[model samples]
Target: MATPEKTGDVAVHDEIQPAPLTTTNTIPDEYRELDNGEITAEALGGMVDDLPKGYYRSMSFIGTMLALCLGQSSCYFGFVMPANVLTIINEDIGPNPNYVWIALIWNLTQAVAFVLVGRLSDLLGRRWFFVGGQSIGLLGSIIACTAHNVPVLIVGSAFIGIGAGVQLSFGMVVGELIPNKHRGFGISCIFVSALPLTVFGPVVIRSMILHMGAGWRWSYYFNVMLLTVVVALFYFCYHPPTYAMLHARRANHVSPWKMVDFVGVLLFTAGLLVLLLGISWGGSMYPWKSGMVIGFIVGGAAILILLVLWEIYGAGDYPLIPIHLFKNRQYMGTILTAAVGSMVYYSLLVLWPVQITMLYDTDSMAIGWKSCIVAGASLLGQGACGVLVRVLGKHKLQLMVSVSLLTAFTGAMAATTPETPGMAVAFIFLASTFLGYVENVALTIGPFCLDASDLGLALGLLGATRSTLATTAQAIFTTILSNKLVTNIPKYVVPAVLDAGLPQSSVTDLLTALAAGNMTGVPGITPGITAAATEGNKQAYSHSFQIVYLAAVAFGVCGVLAATNAPNSESKFTNVVQRKLHHTGFDNKTTKEAEA
Candidate 1:
């Protein structure tokens, strides 16, 4: 082999090349020089030479698959655990007060941490932060497991949120290692693994809570064990990709200080934390018009403005978020669609179980099992879409179909009434399935638009967007439900009580008693008041569901519009040649010159 020559910032090989054995074997002339002074044939061959002779025997491949599986399992476990037991916790701890703030705080904290940690990991490597986050989460789990009060549980949940933020860094790391041809398959596989977890996690948690006389604390303990194992495995077996290794190999520059974006991070965190806290507490703890709420909103808005100004003007070329990425029409569309989809999906997850318990008078275990039907359907939908993408090669079409189905289901759900048939349960399952398809499609599509180097940031942004939207959606939906329930309960129940021949003065007492889940407070009421109150409770729940479903329908329609504008599957770029040609002005002449 002849000596490699430097051209501009790239190296070029001057020796003859060998025949390509696989598509990935084709090294573009730009990277061909980085082959360490070897001919193209030698360099390209060496890149993939580490593969095992047989697929099953490849320990590295197996490890990678397990890592992906664990990642999805952790995400599914984290999300479904809270939804399964939220109603029970509220009933036990809330004492008739709305616990919507709990949901909002969990989501908001996760979003804030995800963006801050993601950018930090991008600058500082993923190892220590990831390990430290898992440790903190473990401590939180211990606190929650041992907690006797709601305040302690909320603190524990905050730890879980921080851990989730740290775990998101793995998405980018996995993307970097997987081959382009297998990238979609790898992602799909990870997502598919979540199916079992989502379907069964709630069921198992609820069962444990009921059968063992355990509280929600046991669920936290289970998660602690699982996460501890995961942390240990990651610490011992995995090595995070370094900034120097990623950029230096490609002849790109790395500036540690610029990459950190400390000011941008601080401002972003402060803004998001304040905004989420305000949203969580407003209408639940403090009235929306209260001074505390106003202060949080105003403070958060100010911090957000500072973040935007710093990123746009003061950061120069090293802004934490490369705002230019948002200019891509497909990127913008996908992100918007993801936000709306998350809002609808997560709100339903939080509210549906409560509705089931209130309407059917079911126990937590039954509600948990019923919830599994939706997640099971989602798993099926995701799997079916993944196969369709592989065969029909129409990712966007699948996404559109999924969004349309979700919109229809949500719209139908909005029309539900006290007399709505039990068969309406199928709609929840269908909606979940469609939403799952939307999520899978968006996850696959977002990364295709960016270079491999930016995959981590892309995944982080996706998580952040989803978390933020979900937090706001939970708050809005909960407020609507609480207000409507508070108002409509009297209207429907008062009439029913009067018709049942109960004393008129007892109406207010009956409602207050029902809201507290106690029936002993009303005086001069007949035995029929219990039946009338049950009917009243049903009506109140139906009304809340009606409003929730309407909001979900609106969100689904927005998601559909966003998905319709997203790029088609054919626009995906994978090969080094395609990426280089797209970035630099690579034409046939440049290719021929490089060959010469």
Candidate 2:
């Protein structure tokens, strides 16, 4: 009654009238409906006030931001945890020649699963897949905690890898949902989470292994608890929009067959699997020149070629990666920067832990704490980069600077020797900070270069690139580390054993024993011989660090060059606008009219 009393001054005005005429030129019923479907002035005006503008207000906005943060942290944890536990596992299980396989399997499984599961997430609802992935990761930790042998541990690692692939899918989902203004900050948050986990994961695992009775198993169990808590939180709070819902609302169509790119998925999965298998077994399980290794490499190359062709030309309407995305120079440039950045970042991760343990002669716990410095610094660096992006309106320059810092850090680390002062640890920490800066910039810029419709597939390809680079880096760097160890250990340890007056048979056994880090075989040698061999082992490890550090510098230099070529801010903004217009079905005429 109160509202009815206020109904006044409401003018019902018909200012214009249209003359009615029947003609063949009249709009058809369907065309009239299509014209009506166009976004109206009222709709545009309404969105200006209601649409989310930044990270603080929207629930879905905040949920996605947190989801991406947690998701990235979980992925990095799985990737780096095994490397942290490598020495501890070797000590407990006795050094088997197959120890490298345990490390390789983690990277291999992630590379293989990323493409397959990412596409499935686009086909299914992202909310369930995201939650399910975390659940699967929890199961992996449970299996790892109960693993009794190397094979079981490898199986557990594969599950963790799959979970990582699923977690990565959230990058695409969140990128799709967040408003353009807040996206760079949200993506930077994800990378910020990664820096800590990368730097600290090893440190944490090492500390637990040294202190706890069953350190390695307990470390796995701890991850399970953490991931389980995150999963529960995600289930209760996160709600990603479904593909069906989005498509139905936006395109007014829902066809599963049209939505999926099944053949592309198969080819990509097969190609990645073959490539990873080749890298995993080429030198360790089978000779690099062996028929099995060569066959895998060749077959993987073939499938990759086929995949590119299908994505570019073979697929009529549905392609996993839209070929047109590559036409955008900014998009391709950002992706290139990301690929190189991932390679350097993960390679350093693979090498640094081994270097610390071998050089410092510390147990896992000490290494874990030492690693915290790098991870913590990286978080700070990422935060700084985000601030700079907002102030300067230039992200590519930050990427270039980060790459230069990483290169400098790597070169400084290469200069370290066994007799180097404790201050050298600062070099590693600084390198981690620069690496984090590079990561934040690349992650922020990559998705922004693409159209909204391409966000899911673009992120999937980004994950694929990161996984591929990580696997390649692990394979190449491990090969370098192993070769260096093999070459240096004999040169240093053998001469030291003979100089100490050990018998020929004893010297041979002692050298082999030292290479494996088992002092039991040195009992036959004199006490002088034992002391010499221990010093010799230290010298060999120092030499290996030099090799790893040099390789890191080279990788960093390449990353810098790639970053230098990255696209500028104006190009990225233009590309994003074009993509959004395309996805919203606003043709050039409509866009021009709206602006006018």
Candidate 3:
């Protein structure tokens, strides 16, 4: 037996070690009742009812929840809200060809920063990163609200994206502080707490755009106020066992900063940005065979290959991603599921509003209400999945079922027509519902399979990988929509207008006017011809959108297969809390605290 060295109030091993095993024995003692040999496993099966003192029912826990909810709201406002109102923003700022950059930049920056934020927070601490993220988010809101150009909005989005990475990485915080059996429910509660924003955010933004003089800029202003309060709340209320972990690392003579995989981080960030840039350009900014497009895509793929080699051989003990993570079947399956799920979820988030405006309704308020269907359905699905996971204890089964349902509904969306707005909305609602459930199962599957020390990094990898894949998928879908519209609009609209007795010379004028949403300037345009042109435009958009949904269906099928491979998590769920919340008065004073 060896003596553990003392550092401040914590204990440490003399040498750096691999991640700890995720077993009941590894959970902090205060979270587990004394082994009196009389407590039944049935007693341990309850969710929140079994949560230890410092977690669910305490005031400190309430504070923690409030902080998490506010931060979650900021992430939603910074990315999701802006994404919905991008068209409005473009109208106000005057459209830029690079307006797509506003959304792409956010996803790119978040994916790039996700790796470092997770690793550093694990080594240094979680509190300041959380607070700093909100502060950055506030700055981004300020930048966006004042911006008069697309470039400035893109800049603001980049800053906000980094802040979003912090929130995504730290999502594991809730799982760690609660009973293992309740991880799904616990995480769901945080999301459900932000239900107001998820459901009504789009509608509110749309109303502002239509009714207020400031238009879309008001969304950013609201975020400024929200994030300002969140920054202060997190700074004061969100304290974990970070100081103890830092002290122990210091005692072991391990430099947290030195241990960082800077080279690995840079390689990953650059590789993803280059890859995404290449994807964004193909069929839009540049031709597929053009030197800029091919060069970026191939060069980025090569950099990623180099990164894999560096992680395996070049980085001694401090690889950015633990090599073992790649070997863990459960971990690999979890992240894979996460990536595919995000692809489906964000596809709807980004494209559904466009679909509404193009095919169903052009009014701002109508578009806003239509968009709310997805969010409302998704929240219900999240709550259901969380409750079911707690009761059934079959994570793999839940994942398989959810992903399959999502696939079926998404594939159904490909059948949409200009005349079937009702059916299209139904398909979106069902797809979004299952998409939410799939996300919960994927996130819950992680903690049960990995070590506490690895959890933060693992979560980071999940967020980064999912963000990257989803962003790539989005770029592909956008390209498909753009290319299809180029062909389909003229294919459908030109014929109908010509057949309706419009002169040959007026054909071009009609198209340009229709594209600009104003038929006032077109020659030879009449009420009957205007109606014909409108129908043709809707048909073209419907067909183009159908292609996007089919692509989403392909991704969804892959997710279903991945879900089938997820590890059984029944045994992993228990009364044991992996990490206990400290600095909270509800913790048992008599028990010695556990060190990370």
Who wins the lDDT comparison?
3
Per-residue lDDT for 193-268 in model 2, tens only?
6675655776666656667787767667767876886787667666544444333322333355665788887888
- The clash numbers for all candidates, in the given order, read 0, 5, 0
Candidate 3 is scored at a TM of 0.88
lDDT of each: 0.66, 0.64, 0.76
Tens-digit per-residue lDDT, 337-396, candidate 1: 878877877787777777777876466567777777667777776676556564555666
Q: Which stretches of model 1 miss by more than 4 angstroms?
A: 1-24, 27-57, 75-79, 86-104, 168-170, 249-258, 571-596
TM-score of each: 0.84, 0.80, 0.88
What lDDT does candidate 2 reach at residue 502? 75
Superior candidate under TM-score, 1 versus 2: 1
Tens-place lDDT per residue, model 3, 49-168, is: 333434455555667778777777777778887788777688779689889789888888888777777766665667777888778878888999899999999999999888888766
Model 2 residue 583 CA deviation (Å) reads 23
Q: Pick the candidate with the highest TM-score.
A: 3
| Residue 205 in candidate 1, Cα distance off native in Å | 1.7
- After superposition, the stretches of candidate 2 with alpha carbons farther than 4 Å from their true spots are 1-49, 52-67, 76-79, 87-102, 116-125, 191-199, 210-214, 249-254, 421-423, 503-505, 570-596
